[model samples]
Target: MNAPFPIRKECPPGACVCNRQALLSDPQADIRILKLTREEESRLLARLETLSSLADLKKMESRLHEQLGIVLTITPSIHEVRTLRGISIQLQEQPGLCRKTKQAIPAAIRRSLEKSPDIAYAILDAHGLWDGT
Candidate 1:
């Protein structure tokens, strides 16, 4: 008797564990690139500008600390005025905070960037991809 042939199972093209076949045929598939409209671009640019200004301010603060021995505390108004967003900057004087507080500053910046209107639009577009938008 001949040895039993091995059984083969194959998935159709465009079909996978997530069953993305229907999604692949979406007419608005190019929406991903198109979602970043001019308005959204401008908003993101504005946020970036604010971030750059904040960086400059932080540098100035550091210089003041070194030259004048004045520790500049980051207040809410100053943060908003500098960045146009309420991003917290970890300071040394604040007790009970982490030792390397400066490391947490980047995370605050990242969180603010993620909350930008342009980023929110991009996230919405990504979610729509699965819905065949």
Candidate 2:
């Protein structure tokens, strides 16, 4: 399957720690997926398993890193009013649900980091995110 969302090639989103270099200036762009219900999940899986490979998983996961929230470390133990802080607060308050992407990240991140200068590898451990690895 093709990527449901766009992956930045030039200025990647993880550029701060990676190598975006002001390449992607997506102000309001969102990486979205069709939230599949239980029935939808079963249906899609059946169709995908019939003719999909691991390459599809890898590509989709790679795109996810660029799709979701950008990497921004929140300064803990100190209250600082900043644009990053605003984003952090909003994320905590109104995070939405995502469907099963069946994609992985660690392998994808490592792959991208080793091969592409535009992609940076940063370790972020969170729930509700699929790292197909």
Candidate 3:
């Protein structure tokens, strides 16, 4: 997916933290499967359960960008993880973000979810993941 913003390197020269070499070789190729531990998955689901509205989830996205320079976009749909029987959600990371920051995005997302118990119940509830029962 194309980044909402223009694609440009966000890191400086010599000491590049944004995967400068790889990005320089191919700026448009940045598809990575971020694996989260089971504990982290549980925590993330727990936090997502607290959200009551889409507005709250939007707040979490903003928080991620503000605090971690990570740009995450929540799509309107979910996919099944065929291997794990778990659901997969879409999170888009824009180019030019530091590798360190990118790696920390999941943890940062969990933190954001903790503060966002007010958004997107209908979305998560589609798969019954947000059911209070």
Candidate 4:
């Protein structure tokens, strides 16, 4: 008598019993990079130049969502660290959303940096630079 070999079964992600939602919900699991064109970068800088208050930031967030489909949460922070001394920006999790960094800078930071073009210029390349750069 010949014995049959054990059968191997592979489960698809959708059919798997593992907690997929938990894995998918992890903010750090699916990091994405955002690339902006010259025109877009210029538009963003122009917006930043006029950012005067949280209300303006809200409008900017709405505009970004409509134009770029990105979710952003900008808030002022009082951290002792130089990098975090001004403000922080966070990209909220949403389907079809991919970003280079997880953080962002708030309007207050932009207002404060109005007098320091050098610092703003250094951080202008990418919004993520406000995190720790």
Native-referenced Cα lDDT, model 3? 0.47
What tens digits encode model 4's per-residue C-alpha lDDT throughout 5-83?
3211223555434333443456654222122333454557566656655455567778767754567765444443244
lDDT of candidate 2 over 91-112, digit per residue (tens): 1211222211223222233344
What digit string (tens of lDDT, one per residue) describes model 1 on residues 1-133? 1113321122345442322233234553322222223454345335433443444445645753563233445433322233424433444442111222234343444454455545333333343423653
Q: Is candidate 1 or candidate 2 better by lDDT?
A: 1
Alpha-carbon shift of residue 82 in model 4 (angstroms) = 9.6
Q: What TM-score do all the candidates reach, one by one?
A: 0.21, 0.20, 0.34, 0.39
Candidate order by TM-score, highest to lowest? 4, 3, 1, 2
lDDT (Cα atoms) of all candidates against the true structure: 0.37, 0.31, 0.47, 0.46
Best model per TM-score: 4
Model 4 regions lying over 4 Å from their true place: 1-36, 76-86, 92-133
In model 2, what lDDT does residue 18 have? 27
Checking candidate 1 for backbone clashes, the offending pairs are none
Off by over 4 Å in 3: 1-54, 62-70, 75-93, 111-123, 126-133
